[model samples]
Target: MKALFIGGTGTISSAITKQLVEQGCELYLLNRGNRNAALPTGVNLIQADINDEAHVAELIENLAFDVVADFIAFEPAQLERDYRLFKDKTKQFMFISSASAYQTPLSDYRITEGTPLSNPYWQYSRNKIACEDYLMKQYREHGFPITIVRPSHTYDERSIPLGVHGGRGSWQVARRMLANKPVIIHGDGTSLWTMTHNSDFAKGFIGLMGNIHAIGESVHITSDESVTWNQIYEIIADALGVKLNAVHVSSEFLAACSKVDYRGGLLGDKANSVVFDNAKLKRLVPEFVATTRLDQGIKQTVAYILAHPEHQTEDKEFDAWCDKVIQALDAAARSITE
Candidate 1:
């Protein structure tokens, strides 16, 4: 089958493209060519701003595709534009949505696909929900062939272990503990965290794509296991075999720090702790499961960080804060497990 992938250069999208190629499908990529993505040798490349409806329409007017995977469409307008442009040409449209679309104020547990969407507070989640609504409307009204895949936090070997806001990873916590630095934790560090390996998520995406019965359905791509923030830090601390000097700060304080317009804090404590349900995805792709556990994922990430010494940071303040957080997390984890 012929397929076109938008935002084909991103971490997750790149993996999806690679898997599709391996399946012997004719692949075409559509992106601005900003990221130096290595496409398969025979894949076709189409460079166009998706926002430019006229340009996109003109380019793909005569083209026909079996599937179009939209990895970067967050705006409803973009969805409408693309749907209008490719509705007739493409037989199926797949939108890559985020599990963050789920509404906050969650209970202390994982959330399934049936959970309600997050309140329209953040633009990112709001826009994603808007696009999903649009897709659903089109599907019901015009019989548009669309499938939605919501992916939770995903990591891989190439994943840069930074927080969602581009800070350090858990490995950095281990390094700080080993070096006798402080670790910082926003709030109580009790929030549950779950991450999926990129490879596993990609495999799920491919599975859904080939399954004709998946059309007009929304599925999540994630791991079945869940871990708390504190648990994650303790795992890293154990791996490093070092005592942690961790500190717990109020989420309100971190939110204020993030708003101080400083370099180290762009995010607030309110953003911590989100859980997702991957049962639907697991049921769909029974053979595809996350091979990397939390500890294994952390070890791989730590090893990568250590091997790439050039990527190290010498920020003593951040390092100390990380160490403090890690220590507190270790204590909390021990208490919970006990």
Candidate 2:
């Protein structure tokens, strides 16, 4: 099969790109070519800005693909542009959505593809929900061969995944761990969460590509393994060989206090306990199994980040904010005791 990936060199798409190439698929990556250095062998690079529709059309003139996956289309406008661009050019069009688009303050803790999509807390998720709606509408009216994929907290080797952190990156959380400073774990740290490795995600994703059964379907690919927020923090700490100083704070309080995007990160998504039902994905891809356990994945990710000095980015402002939040919470507890 011939496949084309838009914005392929990202944390999640990068693994999908490599996996397709290894599976003997002729793959072409459409991006700005900035991260072309890390692309796997047997992959072709199509250098052009996707926003430049005229130029992109001219570049791929009359070229068709068996599958075209868009990893960067977040909003309806982008998906509209994609629909126009690839309407007649590909056999299958995959739009990468987010698991956060699922109903917030969920009616049920167990999530399936049948779960109704609704989120009011985060505009980002709302936009993604809109994008999915548009794509599904297109698929219904025009048979657009649409396959919607929603990914949860999927991580690669570049950075460690954390429940709460600054905008810069997740490195600051690890820096706090190394310094024995308190790191925030939103809520009582008992809320269940699933963290899937990028490589593991690729397995289920690749199975859906050019799949006949997957057409006109909405599927979220996530690990069957679920761990508590406390366990996630402890895994990271264990990977770093350090004792975690966990500071538990209410999700509402953190959202109110944070100047960052914590509102969406917490109230919109991470704040809720989610146990994804990959039964749909398993029914489609019988061999799909996420083997990378949380502890094993975190250990490798930590080792990679530590071996590379460039990954240790410290944010003084975020560090100060963490301290301030901790102090305020402590002061409130003391007042109650008095």
How do all models score by TM-score? 0.81, 0.98
Error of 1 at 317 (Å): 9.6
> Relative to the true structure, how large is the alpha-carbon lDDT of every model?
0.71, 0.93
Off by over 4 Å in 2: none
Candidate 1: tens digits of C-alpha lDDT, residues 282-310: 67777777777878886776677667775
Residue 327 error, candidate 2, Å: 0.9
- The reply for model 1, stretches above 4 Å from the true place, is 160-179, 237-243, 260-275, 309-338
lDDT of model 2, residue 292? 97
Superposed by TM-score, candidate 2 places the C-alpha of residue 316 at a distance from the truth, in angstroms, of: 1.1
Residue-wise lDDT of candidate 2 within 46-120, one digit each (tens)? 999999999998888879999999999988999999999999999999999999999998999999988888888
Q: Which candidate tops lDDT?
A: 2
User: Candidate 2: lDDT of 130?
Assistant: 96
